[model samples]
Target chain A: MKTEAFVFDAYGTLYDVQSVSKITCEKFPRHGELITQVWRLKQLEYTWLRSLMNSYRSFWDITEESLIYTLDAVGVESDAATRAQIMDKYLHLDPHPDCHSALDALAGVPLAILSNGNQGILDTLVENTGLDRKLEATISVDKVGIFKPHAAAYELVEERLNVKPENVVFVSSNAFDACAAKNFGFRVAWIERVTRKAMNREVDEAEHVGPSTMFKLLRMQMEDLGMEPDYRLTSLNELVALR
Target chain B: MKTEAFVFDAYGTLYDVQSVSKITCEKFPRHGELITQVWRLKQLEYTWLRSLMNSYRSFWDITEESLIYTLDAVGVESDAATRAQIMDKYLHLDPHPDCHSALDALAGVPLAILSNGNQGILDTLVENTGLDRKLEATISVDKVGIFKPHAAAYELVEERLNVKPENVVFVSSNAFDACAAKNFGFRVAWIERVTRKAMNREVDEAEHVGPSTMFKLLRMQMEDLGMEPDYRLTSLNELVALR
Candidate 1:
């Protein structure tokens, strides 16, 4: 019944992955959005595919690989400048508006980030977002050579925190990540941000899939697999109430 | 390389899953296309998700479950009569025009189907489409309790046919399946039917993912992981040339 520590997913949960859209749209006005959509999906897919294949790649490498594929697939010219700009955008992803206050409210609780990002990327992201002071530890799945949804990724928390899996309250904006953590025996809190709808719907709309079918599939997968998130909320700020 | 047997993926490769459109259009009238796209994606997603979760469900149940979700998500009503009609459509999927001639040409070589379909559904599909006589065996993953892309599912071929994986020339229209078969040590022939382009693009266009980014990702995954299909052809009729 008692929670010992809070674990967070970095991309799309604490930080806005599409914050790069401004420069992306400026660089390639017509294809920027599709580039973002494809880039993000490929980033995650590469992780699972690698894990399933028993091959390993750092998240940083996967991010660049996916970005290259996105640029080619969307017919964007990926010059050196454009590549550098986008990669920097990833390094300096802006935290969600609620991030600071939510963590501030839960300052008494030990906080950590469990991310697919390599250690260097997580350190840069944390410092760039001014989250260094608030976070007790930042654990990267790079140590395990596999990505999230793999039980080994979750085990990093147990190893680092020295706490039982039951005592960890993992929070993620992604349903699959939350479901994976739940399957790994963590009490999960799913942060359902409002902007998440726009991202899901716009990507689905652009991909020509149904309005909400992608997100719906994620939820359905979680439900069908019997790994429902312990709690869902519109904002991470709601976590303060739990504390 | 001597291919002693040609093993096929039943659903999308041999049987046209979209053949259900005739009756679906009659019933839904307005949302038939979107329903088909969403239904197929959800069906495959369920299998992958279940495999990742290590929970298995019969493809029949997964097919029905995806249909129910598709109907509800797309705002179509799913009455008992409607459900029965759509489910019946799956049992009577039409095989591609090339299926007969291709198998006929390869009459000297043993032909079999290795599918995610449960035994009953595979039997019904084969019997309904008159493929029973042509197929030497219909191998279902039901006995293994897993779906395609999993090693265990592909093992069904070896177990049923008593052929080494290398001696079986595995064919799948789905790139992920092709990649998995390749990884499992089968010399794979990927059937690149023209309509596959429209289906991949439409689904991507509808799901708003990309023109063919999903398939592209599968190919990329295979390449990045060092598993590549040995051969690719435009039609099943091309199989005759292989001999």
Candidate 2:
């Protein structure tokens, strides 16, 4: 299949969201991993909740709010300076190791990011990771005032790139985003970073699974939503062969 | 304040959803607690997801799908019969210990249930728990083709009870439901079953927090969604004094 533009979901697809755990660990010591997992989950939850309630907030605002909730819920106390330091990590999340190599492989292919992140942070994040040099545009859900898996958020890709959904290979590591993109008629590539078999083996072997394992068991697996992605790739490197 | 009707959320408010853990433990052995927590969380996620996607499915369908997903993710194998047996528990979830007394306390006042459950299941579950005698109506989001946290779902209360939002006391132990109900203009009474102070104490006291504790941390607290419930009560019994 010939793809027009490789439109990607920025957070999990291109960048390493778990990279935030580094700063979290430094600041809160043992609670880093827990906070990281809960923060991301709540951040996504806030988007869906707001979208359903017809109350739209910027992804940045949602990120901070979810962080506060996570810290409070995790029983960690943090002042403004510490919180700001933690929040600042979003604008500089490390890109996945395979990101640059995969982008380089698809050199001539038109590339852009469609993210739930606001435009300012999306632009800053891409630039910080040196990914901006490789991409054409960084699209944010802020344009549509709703987060994906909403159809309107997906429409931003077509409006910005002048490419139809069928022509664009929308790639996301997030199961919900991938399913929603496909449901919106995009040729979706879901990055299956963690396989079900691997997860099952871990659960079977480990006597006691931690919060991170539980998070994976709950959120990382593919959703049972009727829509499924067109392609299930193990990593961004696989995107090159598809194109 | 004069309340026109007292509308309660079915799953976590009037009923104890964790009661299903008894059956899940019987079926899955050691993995029952994990499955029960994951299943409930995913069940609620599916409703919000479907609502946001404009892909409305009955709560019963969502419940089954989430269970299937949870079993697979947890690496436990189950046949249709076992699955059906487990699903059967929803219809007979134990009402909270305080449920009947709270209903009895407000005998002269109008009482109803506005739930994400479908009409048939809602009716069946209420009757099974013997809450049918006390509840004047069991309102379902199925009628609205969307789940709670959506404005349309809350409108069903007014349509069915003919009570204005201001005069209605929407009681929910589910934080999202309570917040959304309040956002929808009801005088929401959030049953603070698991307080943040208690959650923090648990986190501080425990060396390793379990999935149930994490579930409470992630979900049981009031959301920072810019809408706060009108009243915060420790138990459903406290709901009596409000009237």
Candidate 3:
């Protein structure tokens, strides 16, 4: 596929979502992992719920709200100072190790972030990680007042980059986002960073079970929903090969 | 607040979603609870995912798809006969202990179910549970080609009952659905059956911390998203008092 531009999901694909785990683990050694897991799950749920309700809030606010809910759920004391401290950590989240090198290799492609983050927060995220100089556009779905997996959110890439959906290579660590982008007509790739084995084994098992029949059934299901990811990679390092 | 019509959410509110736990436990003694929990979570997720993808599959299909995914995730062998047997359990799911008496007490009001279930499955479910004689309208969103919390799904109640939204009382055990119904202009009651104390305590603690100011803030957050549930009751029996 000759891709004209590459649009990436910001939070998990490029920036490691669990970067706060180090500080969090130090603060509450026992519940750090649970907090991180709950926070991220609530963050995603809030976005989808807000979208379905047609109530749009910036990702920053949703992040904070999710934090409060997480703290309450985990039976932690919600001290204001600790809350502000964690919120600050979000602003300075470190990028994944593969992020810079991959972006450097695909330097010629018009790159942008099509994120749920509001314009200001995403702008800071790009600049804080020195991705400001590397990326061509820092696109926010705030312009359309919705979140990812929504067609309009994906449309921002084409709108900002002035490229057709068919020409864009959209990448996300979130399988659902990648599937949504594919449904929106983008050639998509899912970065299977954590459960790489699970993804590979499912395909392999399907193939081994009944020749192409099982594989065909799986593919047909994805095709039926326009959710078939064009590629699955363990890291962004693999994107260089696609180029 | 005179309720001219009573519209209930079927699953989790009227019918116990965990009714299959008994049989499922006998089959998979070690992993039954995990399977049930995962199955319910994935079922809700598939609904939201499918809605966003603009690919509407009936609730029956989504239920089965979630079950398949849950079984695979748990590394259980997917047996065709076992799958069909569990699905059969769904059709004859027992109503909660409070369901019958509550429905009987409110016998004069027009009662209906606003659900995601397709007509056939819901029809069988209602009839199998003897809810057919009790409920005036067994409405399915299948007619609208969408699912619950969608404004259109709630609109069917007003249309069929020949009543205004203000005259309808929408009751659900699902927090999200209760909130959605409130947003849709119904007098909504949330049946806080399982986690009643937790929900009440959160609001109470928030209030105790800073007078009604904290309560106001908490309510405002819910109000902002149209998620404010007007009444929170521990049981359907309490619903009778609302009359």
Q: Which candidate is the best by DockQ?
A: 2
Candidate closer to the true structure by DockQ (higher is better), 1 or 3: 1
lDDT of 2 by residue, A1-243 (tens): 579899988888899899999999999997888899889889999999999988999999999999999998888989999999999999999899999999999989899999999999989899988998899989999988999888899999899999988999999999988888888899999999889998898888877767888888887899998798999999899898777
Rank ordering of all candidates by TM-score, starting from the highest: 2, 3, 1
Model 3, runs deviating above 4 Å: A26-29, A196-226, B196-226
lDDT of 1: 0.76
- CA lDDT, every model vs. true structure: 0.76, 0.91, 0.75
Q: Is the docking of candidate 3 incorrect, acceptable, medium or high quality?
A: incorrect
Model 1 chain B poorest 10 in a row by lDDT: B215-224
Candidate 1: where are CA atoms >4 Å away?
A: A75-81, A194-224, B75-77, B194-226
**Against the true structure, what is model 3's DockQ?**
0.17
- Deviation (Å) of A137 in candidate 3: 1.0
Candidate 3 residue lDDT tens string, A1-243? 588888899988899877977766666665665567556666776787777767778898998888887666555676888888887777788999999999999998888888888888889888889999999998998899888777888888877889999888899987678889988899988887645345335544542222122211221122223357999788898998776
**Error at A112, model 2, angstroms:** 0.6
Model 1: per-residue Cα lDDT at residue A68:
78
lDDT of model 3 at position A24: 69
Provide interface RMSD per model, one decimal: 6.0, 1.0, 12.9
